[model samples]
Target: MSRITLENIHKTFGKVKALDGVSIDVKDKEFFVLFGPAGAGKTTILNCIAGIAMPEEGVVKFDGEIINLVETAKRNVAMVFENYALYPQMTVYDNMASPLRSDLYRQNEDVIKERVYAAAKMMKMENLLERLPSQLSNGQKQRVAMGRALVRTPNVFLMDEPLAHLDAKLRNAMRTELKEMQANFGTTSIYVTHDFMEAMSLGDRIAIVNQGKIVQIGTPDDIYYLACNEFVAQLMGDPEINILSGLLRKNGDNYSFLSNGSEFVLPADAALMNKLAAYDGKSVDIGIRPQHVMYSFSKDAGYRDYQVYSYESIGNKSVIEAYPAGHSGRGDTHTHVRMIAPNGLTIKIDQLIYIDFKLDHTMFFDGSSKEFIGCYNEAGIRALSAGKEEA
Candidate 1:
């Protein structure tokens, strides 16, 4: 096992900055995932560590030793690219054992055959070892590529979207297999992917990178529940987090929220009030995950009024679209709010609906800066009170 670290890394391609001062630490035997949209510099970071691409600035270190000067083969790192990059003319047996031929340790034919078969068994490709790459399925070829990487027993494994070509069912199956492989080997692994589900499921720690800079690094729970910024909050969730525009204003001894001529009183939290007070009469953005929005049949309940606009049933759950009452002029536009409910729930399109805006589940951000103001709940209230008392 090995620990890999990138320090103040910057890579430029002509006028385009591929990586801008990106830094991250992958602990020994840790499965770290680099996640973001395309062109976000994830591959650049992996390349730097693999000695495939050198950054104009910054250092790549392995176990406390700088290895930027080392060649790709000497770095003892294994990389699986998105394309798999297998030799079409080579048989699966030869493909899996190809790396062994160039490895520093000399192995006899029997040893190579043993290792190749073992890797093939792990990937469920043992039966197809003699098939040429062109004759295999996409999933089969990917497994062959993975077997090649596994046969080397390198210090670190860098996988860049290795499962991108598989079907949904096969992709899910591979996810489970990949996690098991990582656990059994206990090798330090850095995986890069644009898929949020894969990152959330596979990584011990995830780094959300953009424009070459790491925006946040944390466990899946932390990144999901306590995003460091608006971009992180917006990027990590499915159906996307809903961003509602509103205003913060002082109302007597408390704070009030105003949006599109609608207003609501905020809970008493000196700290929270103080935080909002800074943005008095100014626009702010509030984020609410679909799961946080609750629907009820009762009109007198503690919830605002809305009208269901549409319904989309996606297997296990239903996504209902709604618009706040009296703001129809906001015009079938930004008024659309999505709510996720169990499959059996009885809801109709264009029906009157009531939603409890579980304020405790909301996140506030400064509209101008797009930075997190506070995450809802008692801790946010406490932090707000602490900030107020300090003032």
Candidate 2:
């Protein structure tokens, strides 16, 4: 396998900018992921790498040599699309064997059978080898599509939302199987998906794309706890992170944030206080995951009591939407604070409940620039740009 690199790539579709100066260095045999929302140019990147779509600017390289001019057939890369893209008239076995029978591979019948069956076995589709695509279930069809790619011994594997269309159960099963299969082959791969499940569970490192640009690249832990901006923080979680706006205050070395007239005294750290000093008396947004917020039936010593505005039952847990005790509301979407509680907990709308911030888990972002600035964690206060796990 070879290391893959894209340098400052640019591409356009008519008047639309599909990729704007995108660059990434995928290590040899690393399961790297391209993760972002729709229209983020994830597929365009895969096409460029496979020679299906060429960039108007920038270099594509295999190891240290440029492959910008290489033909698609010569690239030795296999791709599995979100659509199965299988032949309707061909049996499962025949479809799986098509690549081997192509001009470049040209494997004999016995070898084709050997490869196809092995792939079918890996996908647990050997029993359906004689059936056509229409005769099999949707999940079965998807497995065949994956089997087609698995039978090939390509230098790289490119997958674009391969499990996007499957039902939740099937998606979970396939996701687990795919991770195990990747481990077995140890093939260099670049997988693209909008789903965090795939990105977090599968990638050794994930590149989060947005509006045709690579915004941030890091391990799942880094991206979740040390997000670069408001966009990344909101995109990485389900039900979304709990975001609150407040006034920042600094009196000498003491620092605290005033949200809805109540003050939250943040632990002091010289370096972090220095960075936040600029925003004193100004409004900034703070974010913490719902799980990190704890609620008590009554007011605790240092915690504030809030009034529950709404609540929803979600499986074994409940999400409670609340506001500060005296708060009327703030205009725009940042009006309410959300908390998570156990399923059986007694709670209701308009009820007053006490809340506390696990400061060690809270994140602060600049209100205007929308970029992550610092956080209050177990290690006291630290800036996110420092990129070190709080000890």
Provide the RMSD of all predictions against the true structure, rounded to 1 decimal.
Answer: 4.9, 3.3
The models' CA-based lDDT, in order, is 0.83, 0.85
lDDT of each residue in 1-391, candidate 2, tens digit only: 8799999999999999999999999988888999999999999999999999999999999887899999999999989989899999999999999999999988999999999999998888889999999998878888899899888888788999999989888987889888877776667899999998889888888999999999999877768877889899988886689887888988657778887677888877666677788899888888889888888886689878788887888776788878877666344337677878777767767789888888667888988788998765524222442343221
Q: What's each prediction's TM-score?
A: 0.88, 0.90
What candidate 2 gets wrong by more than 4 Å, as runs, is: 251-254, 268-282, 326-332, 376-391
Q: How many backbone clashes does candidate 2 have?
A: 1
Residues 1-391 of candidate 1: C-alpha lDDT, one tens digit per residue = 7999999999999999999998899998888999999999999899999998999999999998999999998998988987889988889998888888875755788999999988888888889998999998888888888889888778899999999878888998888887777667668899999888899888888999998899998777667777777888888777678778888888999877787666767767665676777888888988889888888778865677888887777777888878887656246557667788778767776778887676667778888888888765647555554553243
Clashing pairs in model 1?
A: 271-384, 271-385, 272-384
Model 2, residue 302: displacement in angstroms?
2.8
Clashing pairs in 2: 360-377
Best by lDDT: 2
